[model samples]
Target: MDLQSDLPPLCVTCGVCCTDAFFRYSCVTPEESARIHSLGFPVEREDGREIFSHPCTRLCGASCTVYEQRPATCREFRCTTLSALEEGAIDRPEADRRVSLLRAAVQAVRQLLPKEEKIWALRARLYADPAAAPQTRLALLSMDILADRYFKLKGRRFFS
Candidate 1:
C-alpha cells in the first residue's frame, strides 16, 4: 500500500510551517543537528538549545528541497489544523480553508513589514513603538489571531 499517497495533500500545498510565518526556529536534536549541518544547512545554538533558523534555507518557494533528508523537528512538527484533519476533528476542505486564511493573513503582514524581518521580531518592535501605524498593528494582530486559531498549538512559542 502506498500510505504516503493515501495521505491528504494539505502539507505539500501549505508550507507555512517551513517559513517564519509560524516559527522563527525549530528545535533540533544533536543527531539531527549534525545531519542537517552535513546537508549544507547551518545549525546553531540559541538560548542553550540546538536549532535551525527559519524561513528554512532548504525551503524553495514553499517546497522543501531537502525534505527527504529533513530534520526530526521538521518531520515531527504538525500544525493544529493538520492535527485536526488527521484526527477527523475537521474535514479536508475546512482544513484547507484554514490554511488559506492563515496564508492570506501572513501575506497581509508581509506587505506591511520588511521582506526579511521575522514576524515575531517585527511584532515586538511594533508593540514597543507607540507611533506604529494602526493598520500595521491590525495586520499583525489579525495574522497572529488567525495563526493561533488555525495553526499554532496552545502555548507553542514561535521561538521554539
Candidate 2:
C-alpha cells in the first residue's frame, strides 16, 4: 500500500505555510522554543510567549528538514483548504486547484516585489506609496485574497 500517495498532495508539495506567504511568526510552547533553538533556528520571546519567524530555515523546496521534530504548531496546523478536503467538503481536484491558484498568486506578487525584500515590508511600502505600480498592488491583493480564502484562519492572517 502506498500510504504516502493517500495523503493530500497540497500539504506535501505546497508548503506556503512554511514561507512568509501568510504569517510572520508562529507561536510555540516554551519546550518547543528550547528544542527549535537547539536546532539552530532562532526563537524570539513575544509578550511572554515564544515564537519563531517564518520563511523557515528548515524548509528546503517545500519540505521541512526537521519535520519529525518540528514544533507543535507546525505539526498541528491545517490550512482551510486542507481542512475542507479532509472533511469531504471539497474533493482532491478542488483542493489542488486552490493550492495552484495560491502558488501562482504568490509568484505574481514575488515577481513584482524588489529582490530580497520581505513581503510584509513590500505590503507596507505599497500601502504608503502613491506612485507604486498598479500591477504590483493588484498582485498583492490577489495573493492576499487567495491566502485569506484558502489558508488563513478567520481573523488570523498577518495584517488582517
Candidate 3:
C-alpha cells in the first residue's frame, strides 16, 4: 500500500513553513548541512549551528525539490493543521480551506511588497516606516492580522 496516499494533503499545498512564514531559518546538523550545501542550498553558520533561510532554494512552490534528501528539520516539521489532520481532529476539505486562506493572505502581502525577499524582511520594512503611504500601511496591517490568524490556526504564536 502507498501509505503516503493516505496522508493529509495540507503540506502538499502549503509552503508557508518553508517560505519563512513561521521561522526565519531552519537548523540542521553538520552532516545534513554539508549535504544541503552540496545540493546548492545556501547555508549559514549561526552560534555554532548550521542554518538556512527561506524561502528555501529547494522549495519549488509548496514542494521540496530535494524531499528525499531534505534535512531532518524539514523531514520532521509539521504544522498544527497537519497534526490535526493526522489525529482526525479535522478533515481534508477543512485543511484545504485553511491552506487556501493562508495562501491568499500571503499572496496579498506579497502583492503589497513585491520586491521584498522574505516575510521577516517585509515585516521589518513595514514596521520600520511609520510614514509609508496609506495603502502600504493598510496592507501591512492586513498582513499582520492575517499572519496572527494563520499562526493561531496553527496553534502557535505569531513571532512578529
Q: Pick the candidate with the highest TM-score.
A: 1
What stretches of model 1 exceed 4 Å from their correct place? 1-8
Report the lDDT tens digits of candidate 3 across residue range 1-160. 7554676456667877787655788888876766788888898888888888877878888877787788898778766667777788877777777788777777766776656566677666667887765786676577557556543444555432
Query: Per-candidate RMSD vs. true structure?
Result: 2.7, 2.5, 3.4
Q: Candidate 1, after superposition: displacement of residue 84 in Å?
A: 0.7
Each candidate's clash count:
0, 0, 0
Give model 2 RMSD, 1 decimal.
2.5
lDDT of 1: 0.81
Using Cα atoms with residue i matched to residue i, what is each candidate's TM-score against the true structure?
0.86, 0.85, 0.79
**lDDT assessment of candidate 3:** 0.71
Candidate 2 colliding pairs: none
**Candidate 3 global TM-score:** 0.79
- Runs of candidate 3 with Cα error greater than 4 angstroms are 1-9, 114-116, 144-146, 150-160
Worst 10 residues of 1 by lDDT: 1-10
Using lDDT as the measure, the top candidate is 1
Candidate number that wins on lDDT, 1 or 3: 1
